[model samples]
Target: MGNKKNLFTLAYAKKFLNKKGLELFKKSNQTRSSNSFKSLSYTVLSSLILIIIFFSSPIINNFKNNLITQSIEVTNNSKNKLENVLTGKAIENEQNDKLDILQIFEDIFQYEDKSTSTVRLSASTIEQLFKDTKYNLKDVRKNKL
Candidate 1:
């Protein structure tokens, strides 16, 4: 932290990191009890990491659950409305709020992807797909809504 010099430039940063790595490697060979600061730094860093991991789980899980709940509700409401409309029951009830197509689209757009699946595409393949005709997503989604 001396003078807070700009050590972040690519080459300088790499050299600084490599130097720090060698210093830590050398320092670790010394008796752990002798260099209390070294051991303390390691302990503090590890504890901080563990604390972050512990505290963040509940918050992340809650957000994920809320999104899943919303998606499920949207799916169910769309299914029920489609059934009613198809059965010739016109929804004349103005009190009942109709689903917002844009909201559904936004939800899908901002969706939390939990998929662990890996997909690989080559550059030419991606370029070909990019050149393909873009279809209206609204048309298909609107039919369900």
Candidate 2:
């Protein structure tokens, strides 16, 4: 009776192991396939992102630098033009007055921001004014170059 019980236990153990092994192999195959697909997809996406940035980075940087330079130049030109306008006015007034450009802007524009560069007169209209000023500055200097 003892030998018969041991033989039955061995048969049950063998059947269970075979079934579990097959299930484990199937699960591993599915996981491996999915992971491989995901890895390939990720690699392609990363490569494309890198390529786009590599191609576009220099152009974007150059464009940014050009705009900054142009803006500074425009600000300088505005300063000169504003000064000339005030001085010319003072000369025409013929009151022998020494005009101070900064004071004139301060007295006339009278905004509380207390900044020193060319200013947009009104907050709501600032963008269009800035664009026009920049464009005018560009046009003024275009012939000088």
Candidate maximizing TM-score: 2
Over the stretch 1-145, how does candidate 2's per-residue lDDT look in tens digits?
8987667565577678797874322345355688999999999999999999999999998998888666532223566667879778432232537888999888877776657787657754755765766655566577663
Which residue pairs in candidate 2 collide?
none
lDDT of 1 by residue, 59-134 (tens): 9999988876665432236666788899988764436478899998888877755455878899877667646744
Candidate 1 TM-score versus the reference: 0.27
RMSD of 2: 23.4
- Model 1: residues >4 Å from true position, as ranges? 1-34, 68-145
All models: lDDT? 0.72, 0.71
TM-score of each: 0.27, 0.30
